[model samples]
Target: MLTPYNLPQDMCMKSHFIFLTLICPGPKDPGKKIDIYLQPLIEEMEELWAIGTPTYDVSTDQMFVMKVAIIWTISDFHAYDMLSGWSTHDLMGCPICMEKSGANWLTFSGKLSYFDCHRKFLPPKH
Candidate 1:
């Protein structure tokens, strides 16, 4: 369901205002192939951005063209990897840092640790 941002922050969280766009049901995760399922939605969004849709304003009792542009997306890390084509594993897992990601592999734990990596991005006074 697409949540309208124009609504008040609290109203955006309400179930009734949310509109269901698409649904893909399957046994396994689509992973990298999610783009296939999203192609139609992408095309529709492109059309909406280019031409817009006719919408009615109840308060003004007037009709207008409503153009929509996706400002952001919300998804878990795993789904994020699938949608963004960025792996959320290993030393370079941090999307913002990319090649400069300050990740280290712990020899004992056999795991990647970010530790104090975020310090560099913080304000100097912080």
Candidate 2:
């Protein structure tokens, strides 16, 4: 979990707000099987969203229902593919483009090349 974005920039990154929920010990990447490991976390998040948990506020010295929402996630591209169920390989590697990606298969190197494909997203004046 992370701190709310409304907090000061410095406070947002503080250790207090950063909660480490789970850690998967592995010598190899989980790949597409990550959902199996995340099932428990997903269920808990769903419960939190639907029916909040009771929490005590230190500053206010009062009790209230606390609900959690996942606003954003940070991960490498490979892990992103695993979490999102998106294939980050071959010509359609670009998640934004999907089928309309500007990737080209290089016959000489036998690889999918994404050179200059990101130019389409640049500002017109850039």
Candidate 3:
């Protein structure tokens, strides 16, 4: 089942930008990619996203936008992509974006990355 997972301890408890392997967008279920990467990741446990309380990272030797990311998932979300299953439309979004999955899943490479600041200060990815 698709459920909301915490961003990370460092993120929820503190502010930090966690690094994650960039997963390629797909139209179909991308099976076991762990064997193909440096991390042991599964289709259900691979994504790069941030949630509550903004996390931060070093930029020019200083902290930048605080954020956390998808380092591991406990379940598969491909089910959400299936028609009539649970498309991204079902996913929640921050009013800051003025939309839901309506906008788009946070991009791995972008300035305004998905960072919900509703209950916390999830900041935009840099």
Write candidate 1's Cα lDDT for 1-126 as tens digits.
Answer: 688886779899799998887676888898888888999989999999999999998878999999989888888889889888888887778787887888888999898998998899899889
Predicted candidate 2 versus true structure: per-residue lDDT over 22-104, tens digit per residue: 67778987788877788998999899999999988887999999887898898877988888877888777767788788888
Please give the ranking of all candidate structures by TM-score, highest first, separated by commas.
Answer: 2, 1, 3
- Which runs in model 1 stand beyond 4 Å of their true positions? 8-10, 106-126
Who wins the TM-score comparison? Answer: 2
User: How well does each candidate superpose onto the true structure, as a TM-score?
Assistant: 0.73, 0.74, 0.20
TM-score, candidate 3, is 0.20
Misplaced by over 4 Å in model 3 are 1-15, 38-73, 77-126
lDDT, candidates in the order shown: 0.86, 0.82, 0.39
Measured with C-alpha atoms, the lDDT of residue 90 in candidate 1 is 71
The model with the greater lDDT, 2 or 3, is: 2
lDDT tens digits, residues 1-126, model 3? 122234444454332443354454678454444245434443334432333343454344654444334444443444323312333332442223445333334567543434333433345553
